[model samples]
Target: MDPKVLDQAAERAGIIPEYIDAWGQRKVISTETKRQLLNAMAGVADDLALAAALPPVWVVREGESAVLSVALSEPADWVLTEETGRQHAGYLSGGRLALPAGLPAGYHRLALRRELRHWSCQVIIAPPRCYEPAALLAGHKLWGATIQLYTLRSQRNWGVGDFGDLALMIEGTAKNGGAFVGLNPIHALYPALPGWASPYSPSSRRWLNIIYIDVGALDDFQQSSAAQQWWCLPETQGTLSALRDGDLVDYAGVMALKLSGLTLAFRHFITRGPEDPQRRSFEAFVREGGESLRFQSTFDALHRHLTLAGHPTEGWQQWPEPFRQVDSDEVREFRLKHHQDIRFFSYLQWLAARQFDDCFQLSRRLNMPIGLYRDLAVGVSAGGMETWSDRTLYRLEVSVGAPPDRLGPQGQNWSLPPQDPNVLFARAYEPFITMLRANMRHCGALRIDHVMSLLRLWWVPLAGSPQQGAYVRYPVDDLLAVLALESHRQQCMVIGEDLGTVPQEITAKLQAAGIYSYKVLFFERKDPAQYRAPDEYVPQAMATLTTHDLATLRGFWQLEDLRLGNRLHLYADDAIYQRLLADRQKARQALLDALHAWKCVPAKLGKNAERVVMSPILNRGAHRYLALSQSALLGLQPEDWLDMALPVNVPGTTDQYPNWRRKLVREVAEIFDDQGITRLLREVDRLRNKSADGQNSSPRPE
Candidate 1:
């Protein structure tokens, strides 16, 4: 092969020379062979070159032939485009498509119809126009206390907490002199399979999870005949009473009873019919969702088929020839037979949306500047509903993940096939815009899981180790523009999870764009006393003591716990880990000394866990907005929070751990009402009030 051509191919693939040599060395191929290889990768080559050609863009030129490619085993049904205006049916793999010939030379618009799986870019088939400043969506700040919704058990609740629980929690927080109530991601997940639950790994970013719907709390439920006849089962009733007194979330038991009630409620909804207001709203939501409803239905049908057919379902690549590709007629017939199931799926989404809107309304009622802060995951699974449904826009052979960083030694493999960057730009970036719009709906703020992905993604080839990945860039300008536009439309603020090895330049870009970056107290302690002081924390940021993924405050202080982590298969530098251990011990001792100085602890109690733990040196990393997780505030280990042996999410595992399960201990209500926690909360509130009024100012320790 011509070295230069190979070099071009490698560069387009984002492959470094060392890797190329490692993978390709000793392989023999002639110049003719090189030409064929380029042809084979022609579509991909063009996309890579175009994506690398400029920063992420939205405008392409008319009359130019921009090859459209699909990211799947094969192409999709061509007829699918007519129904949805999504071209997912046509190019599941790389192929050239001439841009509609000749158009007015300014910005024109088009839409792709594959719901979340489609991407399109723009073609400028004309002379370059003057640059214009991009507009963005405006969002508000929400500073409030948070308790997981499912953590609360109330008289009205089933076995677990629900939206009503959240409303009550927010009300209580407000009564206690708090402003807001934050919670975990509440995105929709597939409901066909009963307990496949995790709020973060959502089935659809476009909808809410029905699992959170307050079935018994609904007005209709009150009017139901079933309520009049209800004599609860002793065991179930006892469980509910227990939850009503608990302090943490019980996801397993909650899901079981919630699902049972929701199933009944869904039936009731259909049987009773919609009220005038509900009918109008349903019509409106349907109109807005349009083809998204259809695609969702179709995906639901496919999902059911896979479930029934059993595991692996003949990997898309290995399926029978006709059904193997997305565009095949067999797939079209499959959709026809499964149309009802698909429609039910769409109905489920509408139901979830209605409840989600109710939650948002509750937030607004409480005067929260931002309510229902929604979270967006980094990407979807490769062979999941999204990839199967919108096969046209993905690169099935490559996956998205992180490069080697402090979080993971071998980097990380997320297994989510990313959109073809070139196709996204050429098609007007419809997929991204649509997804943003969907997430922004009824949200006070949106938390982007991996904000850095807007700039670039670490692309790993299929079956390749994360260490062998390369950085594939995205059009940051256009991506940010879309985010800004959506945020403005939603009237919500954007909070980027800009933790981890975010490139230094990205923070400035996010700031300039008015997007807030996360600042966790634990990570900020990298320099101990030099970190942002409590008084110096940025108001623009949502300050937190720790995140769900990291060690809670008390967990961080546990020397034995830290050592246990080191012993785990998780990667960490031995030297750095030991140094950190020593530093932590010294800090703990300093805190103990400070407690002695303050006389808050008797000399004997100075060595006590609680007293020694409260010293200034131990509080060295407290920020302006101290977001203490319940677990951290209680000084319980992470396991205590989950009421389990290990953390709910092991950062770098799939099969090794139940990463998204492990519920919290007790109910959300009990957490607030517990005498100890309530007292601490009051003290914290007092400190916060003093800080706000400028009366709590203390000189810098240095």
Candidate 2:
């Protein structure tokens, strides 16, 4: 390693040489790298300084006064204080200003504005906390399910699955054995563009993207003359017809129709909807959103400015001056001018919520135990909605990823920027708690994706590759406490996707807190099996034959599963594949032996036993809540082959892969009604019952 490179990188990361020796051994930085490091650090420091010097904002009690302090670059002649808050004297030696006494609070905004230097942020003085979440979920049960939204559709929806479709699905699932219907995130996308689909990589997480709303189902749409005229159009009629026939989802077409309808509805709302309860509810949502809403509104306006100017809003760094700074007067004025656009975005959220609520209500009506098990992704994109709006809460310079393991030789670098837990706790975990509340609103249970993130995340510097990230610890107790409290309050069951090389402590902690962990059948070893047996599965966890990321049961059986190993050429030599195949054969044999041992299989059972047995995958997993994906039930080897031809995700690649854009081959509505699929569900149900009764079955408790 080059010493000069090491020094340069160290300087860039703001590490003293001594600190470098202590922390950066074996890592080298070139002299040329040092110059780039200096430049980047300078930019980072500039951004940090602006963020830190903003305001003395505090969240306090309504009756209490809030004390404030400021660490500034220079001294000010006069201190600025709002009427509601108290101002104090006695400047510290370092030109820091401290408020001597606290002032009564409601909503307080304190700023230091001395001739062209101004900074401000709204602060809330909260009421005493009466809502502790743990007590809520301790004895509560939930009922819910989640699938790709486009998979299901009703006779009344557009080409893509809409609110109407979801409501129907929820009702149907509840009527069956399920209680809730969880959905992929329906957050808003950049409006100007329609087809850049992937709900996970949304333009905004806080706001609902309007495309999912069912225009024809809305009460307001029926009352509107414009909607009636639009509905009469041949194209509109054709679209509806195609949707009922289970056509592929044309996201662009759906978005176009929805936007036009919503715009018209907004006009109607502003002009004639004077005493409507729905109108009032929309206003209430806006008020409750507060500064967070303001930030989104501001971003929408700025994004439009850049878009109209023929620039990609995605490339904000390349934008000209006055456009780059989020707080510039130009951006502020743009917000004031384009307030309608912001309100439009807000309106979309209201509509989505209304639809989501209907789905939840339908599930409750069906009396399902757990409703809507929503999945929360492990992390957010680097500069996406969460990162942009909650910048202070995240460390953009550090990326989260997985360490190299048997599966991934070079490890995994998920380019999501992780939250600065320190900043999160300081703000009392408002971001995390809010996200949970939002999800819980229409969910019966919550599935935390990559649940291990609650413990620690590997952080890589922005300039570094996937392999260079460092492991950083988080306050796991506080994180789990918040989750427990929120989940209990929501009366939702929590399931953690505890796959991969998860630290052992995480599983213990989760189990202790009553959070269910995930168990997959594909990873089980049955020959002198290290994998748990059916009776050995923890009664509280969710048992599954496969996950969205892993191959379906059929694919696993055929040795065609896609994973990081295959994608990264880690298994190019075929040695690993051969071993895996051999292991698979052994596992299959073990399952047959166990079943025969239990007297479930007849002595006449032949070589075809492997092909006939579903008990091994369904009965032999270590979780109580057994979930089989539709693909597995259908014997579909590759989910992508069921419709589109691509894996939902290929782990380590971004541009070289399509992460989450595959549309299911079979429309969701069709699948539910399909005779073949229905039979499979019944068969799986039969096997599950047999296994539960301690009949002839394989080991493991799926």
Candidate 3:
């Protein structure tokens, strides 16, 4: 291919020709790789003819009063229709058309006609920035507990943590003056194939994960004879007990138990008269869910059907052509044949949504300030429902990942497809808006994972190594505008996960948009011996000592992560491992010194101590230290409070480590009942209040 043609293709496809690496080195994408990515973007076709025949999608700010330019071969009459169906007609003169400022802020359709030659495009009007809650901007220091919802073990739940556990946890936290409960992404995962249980690798971000539904919380569950009989069985009870007692979550077993009970409940509900009030509510839910819900339910039922018929269910791409396309006549016929099964999945969604809403209501009743904070993953899995339902929006040939850095020298491929920016713009960003709104529902705050993706993403071709990838730019202004609009509409504070290989400009942009930054204590220390002063931390940030991806406070103190990494063969060599160990030792000693200086830990605990062990004193001290920060939001992990040694997830490895299945050392009841844990939380609450009142002492950096 000609270099000029490739350059033009890259420009049109929004592929960045060069980017600054993590080490601040500028690197150029290979010519061949650029060509491949552009081809994967479907931009190599006869674009000249298509471009000449069609008008490109246009975007304007809500109050910009902008004019749109169209390359017209002849004068044409234009008709513009707002999303509300209000239409405006005007005659196109020359090639430019002026738009009225009175147009509402939404997606509007623009149609051009001249001598029967018709063309149409989408015009998006977006707000300037995301919504900023008044409480967040009021300079209040609020504290919350972040937990992997599945790790929450409760007596009432069958095996996995459910909405009931969340409700109970909220009550406990609120009693101790907590403001919110942070959770991992609760996006929809595969119910039929329960073994595929990575929360981040979800089937659909626009729906709830049905596995979190508490069967007993369903309206007719207790009244149903079938459900009661199943729950009363000795074998079923034994299975639930075993799952709850296990160290790792048994996703398949738990899902089986829950599904059996849910099926019975569904049967019992359907037996009710058609005009029952409960039945009407369910129908309304389905109607409101509309096509997205229908597609997800159809995909779930079809996958199960295919699997039962001895066909592979890993991905729809491997299915026969007719069954692959979601809109195909064959797929529609199959859905009709298995309509009952599809509705079963839809019912599960309704139950999950209802249960989650109950938790939100309970939070409100408890008077928790922020209520619940939900996480939003960056992208969906490659063979997931979203990809199958809308193939045109994603570039399946390339994977989204991070380039080689200090953490992973070989680079990291998340095995998730990146959205095609061009296609996303062409669709008027309805999918993006829908996803934002879905996640923000029934939540006070939304945490966006890898928020930098809104501006650009590293697209690694599947056939090449991650190091050979290129950064692809997106319509950042448009996306941010939509996010602001959704945030305002939902009244949810937005927290952007702006860590790792992020540009400084991105941080500035996020800060200006009233989005909170995520700051981990481990990354805040400038040197091994000295942490950043508490007063130096950003005021508009969520501060934490560790994250799910890193070692807990106990693990960090014991250096268990290094040992685990060595056993898992994550280090490049023994030398690198030894270097990391030495660094950890220094950092540990520095932390001990800081704790002594701050009087967080007992001053008698030697400042010169060579090593710190996992103890209640040290764990509580860590929490207190982070609570003293100037950050407006403080998040504490229950695993750290319980002194759990294992990290929830180990980056750069999949099968080698139980990534997301580790259960918390203590159950929900035990955690709430532990006096020591309660005392520590109270101390955190006190310190947070002191900070909010501006009565805390200035940080004494050691």
Each prediction's Cα RMSD? 9.9, 8.5, 2.5
Candidate 3 structure quality by residue, lDDT tens digits, 169-201: 898889888999999999999877888878888
lDDT of 1 by residue, 228-318 (tens): 2442667667776764555444455665566455445544555644665655665687788877666565655565566567633323443
In candidate 2, where is summed lDDT lowest over 10 consecutive residues?
Answer: 629-638
lDDT of each: 0.55, 0.57, 0.85
Model 1 weakest 10-residue run by lDDT = 629-638
Candidate structures ordered by lDDT, highest first = 3, 2, 1
- Estimate the overall C-alpha local distance difference test score of candidate 3: 0.85
Q: Give residue 310's error in model 2 in angstroms.
A: 2.3
In TM-score terms, which candidate is top? 3
Distance from true location, Cα of 207 in model 2, Å:
3.7
List the candidate 1 regions with Cα displacement exceeding 4 Å: 6-142, 146-161, 193-198, 219-260, 272-277, 305-340, 526-531, 560-568, 571-580, 586-647, 655-657, 675-679, 682-695
